[model samples]
Target: MGAARAGNGSDGIATNLPEADDYCLTARDIRCVVLDIEGTTTPIPFVTDVLFPYARSNVRAYLVDTYRTRQTMDDVAFLRAQIDKDLADGVPSAVLVPPPSAPEEEVIDALVANVEAMIDADRKLPALKQLQGRIWRLGFDGGEIQGVVYDDVAEALARWHGTGTVRSYIYSSGSREAQRLIFGNTEAHGDLRRYLSAFFDTSVGGKREPRSYYEIWQTLGVDSPSQILFLTDVYQEATAARDAGFEVLISIRPGNAPLPEDHGFQTITSFAQISV
Candidate 1:
């Protein structure tokens, strides 16, 4: 995750949540809507079942072939730093430490093994996400993978964007390039990227961090947090966006984690139910 930035609410007026039925931004005041990917826009299964396995199976070959590239080298360097930090913290793993002069194949094998372990554990480490995204790109371009989003998403995005009232954006842990690829090459929606104005990822800040939402608000050049509405399936993510002063709604998508019975946020099962 990127470093957090401190800021005030001076850019936009803050507002409290309205009545339950008034949660729709079209009924209230909103200028921009930020969305999460996995559960909010795309079905969780497409990610856990399709994307994860593909990355886990292809990491070795992808890394071996791409390691010399500047971007891949940067990701590897970040992974090495993470491994070093784990070692300093006394975590033990043969894959975590290898001599700098180790054979290229041996190093790649260890890295692949370690990365596969991280995927199994569902670690959100940026380096791992970067590598997986790169691998997925190859899969996407090879016709081996096709992105999936909920049924209501494509139409809602087009409708919302066509109105010229609310600009749409994506803020996921996936890299910006990966974000574009999914929206651009979706199986159901041909080139949905046209509906989106921008994309953001961990390069902003951790999704669950309040500062991240604020940074998004700032980055989008929006007037106030109240003018932005964020949608996510995770209650914690909703809480973070709410705390950051943006209006937030919990997306109750199929296969999404169940929201708590006492969850305070307003919830929606489809984008058709959302406005603005």
Candidate 2:
């Protein structure tokens, strides 16, 4: 929802998958692993059901309050550009900027209004990602929301990092600050941030694009994609990572994943079983 499926691997690699292996990294071949949030570590519902909506509800307020800030002005540019593109396609401003609150369609209507303007202005941007991230920050800090990590994640990550050889990271559409907030606020062993080394978001070309992973590799100064293990619940995302040469792991867990008959990769249920 942020940009990519929450499975880039981990804080170390860049995904959160439903399944992992018992013989992959094994505390030797690799020094770092990237993990994803969402379905990989934190359950999808926490993100979708709570984080997304909370941010959605607060975006309007953020826009109004921050509209004068340099960042919000950037969002205006973002919205203008989106508007221009839609207009070029024969759309009209009437649909672009509807009345402030159109009942059940207020939120979406606002988005359309801003997006149309963005396309019109020719600005491909990250205003929304930024705004949502900021709003979510307050919610997280307020204790209005709680991040959920799978039951098995705590011990596995603890053991993996406890080896003192492996490093972990986080990559998600969420902002770097949001990543810290979630991990730091997680129900499992509060403040997991110390275990993580870095954070990434859609600014990295997004997960669907192969270049994001490449950028990650460059940031890590890692030798090769093959040296890092990319984990996720979405096969399409794993495919992009695999294409980039990062070792791939799939996560399959109850209520989190839809079973695939021919995934063509290793699957895992918990971090406790992961190996390298």
Q: Which candidate is the best by lDDT?
A: 1
What would the per-residue lDDT of candidate 2 be over residues 1-276, giving only the tens digit for each residue?
012233433333434323344745864376667887778888787876787678766766666666568866665566555555666777554245343344534534566455434334423245555556677778888888777777677666777678887778887767677788888888657877777888888788777778888889888887877777777777777888888878777776555656344456776767767753
Off by over 4 Å in 2: 1-21, 86-125, 257-260
Least well predicted 10-residue stretch by lDDT in candidate 1: 1-10
How close is each model in CA RMSD to the real structure?
8.6, 8.2
Q: Model 1 off-target regions past 4 Å?
A: 1-23, 91-94
All candidates' TM-scores? Answer: 0.89, 0.76
lDDT of 2 at 208: 70
What is the lDDT, from 0 to 100, of the residue 217 in candidate 2? 84
Q: What overall lDDT, based on C-alpha atoms, would model 2 receive against the true structure?
A: 0.68
